[model samples]
Target: MARVLEVQGVSKRFLGLKALQGVTLHLEEGEILAVIGPNGAGKSTLLNVISGLLRPDAGRVLFLGRDVTPLPPEARTHLGLGRAFQIPTPLPELTVRENLLVGALFGRPGRSRKEAEAMVEAVLELTGLAAKAEAPAGELTLLEDKRLELARALATGPKVLLLDEVMAGLRPKEAQEAVDLVRRIRDAGVSVLFIEHLMPVVRALADRVVVLDYGEVIAEGPYEQVAREERVREAYLGRRA
Candidate 1:
């Protein structure tokens, strides 16, 4: 299968700090890949670069076989890339439905209002936020907020979804629900690349896992295989001990 997203020899720096160095990874269509590492391992930076929040000091970002290294975030969205932030930041005054509508209407330029509205309905249903469609976004519970964040991203009709710790604040049950939703999303033909801290979530969701330490990939394989790696244990899992 062709890669849905690719990061080739990517590097980024902040003054004297090397946030990332020669990072390389790829996401295959309809697959779910997880990126795991210790804090400050450049997981977020990789997502930002892929989503166009920051351009790499070196390397290329390819989306669907096209070089999108120079494209802006909105431009990338139009080309079928979607991202959900770690923090769910919903528009305070807007209704849940409206929040998704904003993404549907503006995420892909030239989408008709009618088309966006239809998309909003579909997304709300998919994310299980249909019951709260008319509620104020700011009034939602943390679980709902996370759902809304994911729904808004889906509203963009992306071929690949970049998720940043969407399960962070949820309870075990809630996290399971989120996991199920993500599985359904992947089943519906979208590729996913996510940064996650919870090992259980990563194990349950990732088809493949990539471990990063000090800004570089240390291991890439099935969860059990990568989990048993000595370096992965030393750099990340052991710290949880």
Candidate 2:
């Protein structure tokens, strides 16, 4: 399988704080890769760098083999990198379908209104939001909000999707539904790189896992294999005194 996304020796700093240091990872075509870590482990920072929300202090971000380190978020999206935030914040005034239309139209430059509407309809169906397409975004339940967030990103017609803890606040059942939805997304040809705090979600969805600690990668491999690593254990649970 070809690599869809790559982060080479990426690092970031916020004043004196090192948010990430020489972090490296890759997402393969049609694969679901999860980035996991304890708090302050630079997982979010890495996602920001990959999605073009923040420029790394050093290193490169490659999307479909093209260096996109200098591109802005919209440019990256246009280049087939789409992202869904950890928090679902849809526009309250607009209907759910309209919210997705915004993404489809603007996510890729030069997309026509007809093309955007068609994309929105497809996303609405894929995300199980077609029934509520005309409902106000603010009136959605938690699960609906989450679906809208994921749907909006999908409307961009991304080759690789970057999801930032989209399963964070869901119940176990709801998360399972999300896991299934993501699988369908992948089957539809989107490679996924997601940040997840829910271990079960990672175990259920990720084909591979990357663990970050102290702003650096501590382990990378199959979920069960990485789960048993001593370093990974220490990252989440303090070492025995």
Candidate 3:
């Protein structure tokens, strides 16, 4: 499969503390890749760098075979990069459909109102929010809020999507639903790269797993293989893999 995203020796720092150090990974076309690590392992930092929310002090980021290291979040979105935050930050005043419309209209440049509306409708259906299209975003349950976050990202018509711990607060059943939704999104041709702490969700959804510890990658492979690594076990001691 084609490489849709690449991070080469990426590094970041804050007041001499290394948030990320020589980190590297890639997301292949149509694949679901998971980044797992203990808290403060720089997983969110990696996502921020990829989405252009933060610039890396070193190395580069490439998207769709072009270097996007210098691009801002909006520019990256125009180039087929979509991002959903860990915390769902929907506009409280807007309905579900309206919230999605924000992404559709601005995600890419040169889109007409008609095109954006059509995209919003499709995303609402895709993310299982069609029935709640008119509901206020702030009034939805946690599951519904998550769906809206994912839906808003999809409305951008991305070729690659970055999801930051979308299942952090969900129950097991709700997380399963999210896992299925992510698979459907990948099947629809959007490659996914996500940061997740939920091991079950990672096991169920990831085609490949990258383990990060102390701001560096310690293991990268299929779920079963990575789960067996000693460093991964030590880093996540007493936690079932």
Candidate 4:
């Protein structure tokens, strides 16, 4: 499969603290990649750089073989990068469908209102939000809110989706459902790069796993392989005395 997204030698710093150091990773077409790490491993910072929310101190972001390091978040969205926050904050006044319509219309430049609405409908069905389409976004239960977050990002027509701990607050059953939904998203032609703290979710969904420590990649491979690495274990659990 083609490499749809690439972060080469990326680095970020904040007020004299190194948030990321020469981090490099890639997402292939139709692949699901997971980024796992201890707290302050720079996962969020990496996502921000990729999504164009932050300018890296060094390195470049490439999407579809084009350099996009200079693009803004909305510009990157227009170019097929979609993102869902860990927290779901839907517009209180808007209906579920309306919230999705917002993503569809603004995410892709030049998408007509008719086309945007069509995309919204497709996303609602894909994310299983059709039943609650007319309901106010603020009224959704936790699971429904999570679905809406994923649905809104999907409505943007992304070639690659960036997920930040989307499974954070779910129960086991709900997380399993979300795992299935993510698989369907990949099957539907969107490559996924997600940060997840749940090892089960990573093992279930990731084609490859990348481990980070102190903002640097310590290991990268299949889930089980990376899980057994001494460095990874030590990263999660402090080194032996």
TM-score versus the correct structure, for each prediction: 0.98, 0.97, 0.97, 0.97
lDDT of 2 by residue, 39-152 (tens): 888988898999999999999999999999999998999998999998887899999999999999988989999999999988988899999999999999989999999999
- Across 105-168, the per-residue lDDT of candidate 1 in tens digits comes to 9899899999999999989889999999999999999889989999999999999999999999
Q: Report, for every candidate in turn, its global Cα lDDT versus the true structure.
A: 0.94, 0.94, 0.93, 0.94
Span of 10 residues, lowest total lDDT, candidate 4: 232-241
**Candidate 3 residue lDDT tens string, 1-241:** 7999999999999878899999988999989999999988899999999999999999999999999999999999999999999999999899999999999999999999999999998888778899999999989998999889989999999999999999989999999989989999999989999999999999999999999988899999999999999999998874445
Off by over 4 Å in 4: 239-241
Where in model 1 is the C-alpha error above 4 Å? 237-241
lDDT of 4 by residue, 36-137 (tens): 999889999999999999999999999999999999999999999999987887897899999999999999989999999999988988888999999999
lDDT of 3 at 68: 98
lDDT winner between candidates 1 and 3: 1
lDDT at position 72, candidate 2: 92
CA displacement after TM-score superposition, residue 123 of candidate 1 (Å): 0.6
- Which residue pairs show backbone clashes in model 2? none
**TM-score (C-alpha, index-matched) for candidate 2:** 0.97
